[model samples]
Target: MLDWLYDIVGRILVWIHTGLTFIGFDTDSGWAWGLSIVLLTVLMRLLMVPLFVKQMNTQRKMQDIQPKIMKLRERYKHDKERLQRESMKLYQESGTNPIMGCLPLLLQMPVFFSLFSVLRSVAEGNARYGFDEELVESARAALIFEAPIAAQFNSSPEELLELGASDPIMAKVIIAIACVLMGTTTFLTMRQSIKRSISQMPDNPMMQTQKIMMYMAPLFGLFGLMMPVGVLVYWVTSNVWTMGQQHFLYRNQPVAGAAQTKNEGNGSAKGMLSRKKVAETTPEPKEQPKIERKQPKKQSRAKRTGGGSR
Candidate 1:
C-alpha cells in the first residue's frame, strides 16, 4: 500500500542528493548523502508549513475553549448524549476541531515509515524504487562520520560488513551517538509543551498521562538502535525543526494570556451560557390596545332635563 509513497520519498531524497553533487559535493561521499537527507527534511517541512500552522491554530483554539469543555463535562456528567451534543455545538461555535490539532502530526507518520523503508532498501542494494546501479553504489559506499548512512547499532557484524562499514565498532559508536542526539532533541521538544500543558490546566484529566508519557517518550531513542543512521538523522533534524517552530509560534503563551484564560474559564463557555440564559428568561414586549375618551355632549343635559319633567 505504501510502496508508491516510498518511491516518491526515494526520488525526493535522490533529487536532493543530486543537487548536492551539482554543488561540488562528492556524490559517493557518505556526508553528501547525509546532507541530502537533511535537505530532504527541510524541503518536506517547508512544504508542510501551512499544515503545521493550521495545526498550531487548532491547538490554540482547543486550549482557548478548554475551560468551557471542562464545564460541559461537569454539567452533563450523567447525560453522555447531552455532553456530546453540547460539546460538538461548542466546537462549532468556536470554529474549532480538537481532533485536527493531532491530524497534521498523524499525517506525517506515513512519510516517516516510507523514508525508513527507502533507506532500508538502499542498504539491501535495491535500486528499483528511485536509484540506478551507479546511485546505489554511490550511496552504499558513502560514509559520513566514519559510518555508512545505513549503519545500525543493532545490526550484526556480518550485516554491518555487508553494508560496507569498514569498521563495525566505529559504525556502532556513530549510530549510538546519533541515537543519543535523537533522544535529547525529542526530550527538549517535549519540555516546553509539558510545561505549558501543566500551567494552562493543572487539573487537566490528561495531565498525569501526559507527564508519564513525556518521560517515556524519549525512550523511543532506544529504538534508534534498529534504524539506519539516515533515518536517525531525519528524526533528529525533524525534532529540531519542531522545537524552533514551537518556540516561534508560542513565544507569548503560558503566561499573561493563559492567566487570563484560567481566571475566565476561557470566557467562551461562560459567555455562551450567559447569552442563552438571558435569551431564555427575558420577556418580549407586547403592544397594549390604545384608548381615547371624549367629554359628554350638550345633548345629554337636554335629555336629562326632559326626563325630570316627565
Candidate 2:
C-alpha cells in the first residue's frame, strides 16, 4: 500500500532534481538537493492550501460555538456521556467537525515518512522506490558544503567526530541552524494558535490540551538532530510556510475572540465619539430668577381694610 506512495514521492523528488540539473545546478552538489527539498515543501504546501482553509473554517466554527459548548459542559457536568452527546449534536448542528483541523497535518505524515525513507535509502547506497541507481548515487554525492545532504546526527560520537573532521564548519552550522529554526517556528506557530483560542475562551477545557501541545510541539525539533539534513531542510521550510499561512489566515479570517475583541474596541471608539458630539451640540441649563411678591400681597390687604372703613 505504501509502496505506491513511496514511488510517487520518489518520482517527484527525482523530477525536481532533474529540473535543477537542467537549470545548471550540479547534480552532485548540495545546493541542488537542498533547493529540490525546498521546492517540494512549497509545492506540497500549495496543494494543501484548500485543506488549510477548511481547517481554518472548522476552527472558526468551533470558536464561534464555544459559549454553547461551555454551557453544555456546565449543565452536564455530572453526566460525561450526555455531555459528549450534546457536544456532538452541537457540532452537527453547526456543520462543523473539530477533527477536520488535523486533516492537513495528518496528510503530510505519509509524505514526510516517505521522503525520509528515500533519503535514508540513498544515503545507504540502496536505490529503492522509483529512484534509479544513478539518481541515488547523485543524491548521495550531493553536499550542502562538505557534509552530504543526507547526513544525520544519529551516528555515534566517534563517527560524528570523523564527520566533523571530514566536513567543513559551515556544514555543521547549517544543520544546527536548520534544527533551531524548525523548533522555533514550531513553537511560535503553536503558541499563536493557542493564544488566539485562549483569548476567545480562556477557561475552556480544550485550552488546557492546547497549552500542553504548544510546549510539546517544539520538542519535535530535537528529533531534527536524528533526521537527514535534507529532511530537516524540508521540515524547516514547511514550518516557515505554516507560520506565514497561519498569520495570513488569522488576520483575514479572525476567530471569534479576535473578532469580538476588535468589535469591542470599535464600540468603545464610537461611544467616545458620541459623547464628544453630545458635549459639543447640547445647550447648558440657565438659573431661574428669584421674584419678591410678598410686599405686593401685604399692600393689597392694607388697601382692602382702609376701603372697608371708608
Candidate 3:
C-alpha cells in the first residue's frame, strides 16, 4: 500500500541530490545529502502548514468549548456512556474534532518512515525503495563531511574509530553535534508548545500530557545517536520549523482562553481609565447654607391677637 509513497519520497530526495550535484556540491560530499535532507524537511513542513492551521483551529475550538464539556461531565458524572455521547455531540455541533490536533504529526509519520527506508536502502548500497542504480551509487558514496551520509552511530566502535582516523575527528564531532542539536531543538519546540498551552488554559488536563512530553522529548536526541547524521539533520530542521510555526500561531491566532483573557484585560483597563477620567472632569456638589428660625415669631402673633380682642 505504501510502496508508492516510498517511491514518491525517494524520487524527491534523488531529485534534490541531483540538483545539488549540479550546483557544485560534489556527488560524494555529505553536505549535498545533508542539505537535501534539510530541503526535504522544509518542503514537508510547508506542505503540512494547512493541516497545522486546522489543528490550531481545532484546538481553539476545543478550548472554547471546555466549559461546556465540564458542565456535561458534571451532569453525566454517573453515566459514562451518556457523557461520551454528549461530548461527541458537542464536538460535532462545534465542528471540532479533538483528534484533529494530531493530524499534522500523524501525516508526517509515513514520510519519516519513507525517508528512513530510502536512507537505509542507500546505506546498504541497494537500488531498492524506488532509487535507480545510479542514484543509489551516488547516495552510497555521499559524505556528510567526514562521515558517510548513511553512517550510523550504531556502527561498531572500531569501525567508527577507523572512519574517525580517516577524517581527523570530523566524523565523531559532526555526529555528536547533530545529535545534540536535534535533541535541544526538540526540547525547545515542546517547551514552547507547553508554554503556549499553559498561557491559554492553565488548568487544562492536557497540560499534564504536555508536561510529560517536555521531559520525554529531549530524550529523542539520544535516539538520534543511533540514526544517521543525515537523518539527525532532517530531525533538527523539522524541529526548528515547528518551533517557528508554533511561535507564529501563538502570536497571531492564540488559543481561545488566552485570547479571551487578553480581551478581558484590555476591557478592564479601559473601564478603569474611563472611570478615572469621569472623576477628574465632573464637578463636586456645592454645600447648602444653614437657616435659623426666629423664636419671637410665636409671641408677636399672640400679642397682636390680644390687642385686636381689647
Candidate 4:
C-alpha cells in the first residue's frame, strides 16, 4: 500500500549514494553509504520543515487556549450540554480542532515507515525499489566504524562474521555508543518541550507527560539494541535534527503565555500568583456573553432607561 512512498525513499537513498560516488567516494565505502543515511535524515527533515513548524505552532495554540478551556468548564459546570456546545464553539473560533493536534504526526508516520522499509531492503540485499544488485551489494558491505550499517547490537555471531566485524565486542560497543547518543538526544528533545510548557503553564498536567518521557529516554536506548545500526543512526540523527530545528523555530515564535510570566523569571515566583493573575486578567471576548436574558429585551424603553419615549 505504501509502495509509492517506499519508491521515493529508495530513490533518494540511491541518489545520495550515486552523488557521493560521483564525488570520488568509493561505491562500497561504508562511510559513504552511512553518510548517505545521515544525509537522508537531514534532507527528509528539511522537506518537512513546514509540518514541523505547524506541529509546534499547533501545540502552542493548544496551550494558549488552556485558560479558555478552563473558563468554559467553570461557566458551564452545571450544564453538560452547554459545556460541550461552548467548547466546540470556542475551538471553532480559535481555528483549532482537538483532532488537528495529531494531524502532523499522522502525516509523518508514512515517511518514516517508508524509509525504514528501504533500509530493510538494503540489509537483506533484496535489490528492488530503485536499487540494483550492485548497489544493494555495496550497501550490504557498507560499514560505519567496526559494525556494518546493516548490523545491530543483538545480531547473531554468524551475522557479525558475515558483515566483516571480526571482533563481536567492538560491534556492540559502537552500537552502544549510538544508542547512548539516541537516549541523550531523546531526553534533550523532551526537555526542550518541557521547558516550553513550564514557561507557559508550570502546573500543567502535560508537564507530567514530558517528565515521564525524560525518564524513559534511557529505556529507548535499550530498545535500540533491536534496531539496525543504520536505523539507529537514522533515529539519533532525526532526534538531533528535531532538537536543533525546534530550538531554531521556537526561538522566533512567541511562547503561548510569555507576557503573563515575562517578569516571573525562571519560575522564581513559584507560579501560583502568576497563574491566578492570568486567570483574573484574561477577559472573555465581548461577542460571547456568558448568559442570555429574554425579558430585558422584551421590556419597553420605559423600563430600560426608567423613562418613557414618544
Instruction: Name the best candidate (by lDDT).
Output: 1
Off by over 4 Å in 4: 76-84, 254-310
Task: Give lDDT per model, in order.
Answer: 0.84, 0.81, 0.81, 0.81
C-alpha lDDT (0 to 100) for residue 3 of candidate 3: 78
Runs in model 1 deviating more than 4 A are 252-310
What TM-score goes with each of the models? 0.80, 0.81, 0.81, 0.77
Backbone clash pairs in model 1 (N, Cα, C under 3 Å; residues 3+ apart or in different chains), count: 2
Model 3 vs. true fold: TM: 0.81
Per-residue error for 35 in candidate 1, Å, reads 0.8
Q: Give the TM-score of candidate 2.
A: 0.81
Q: How well is each residue in 35-98 modelled by candidate 4, as lDDT tens digits?
A: 8888998887888888767777667777778899888888999999999999889888887767
lDDT of 1 by residue, 124-235 (tens): 8888568888898888887878778876788898888877888989989998988999988988878877786666557778888877878887798899988988999999
**Steric clash pairs (candidate 1):** 30-142, 30-143
By TM-score rank, best first, the candidates go 3, 2, 1, 4
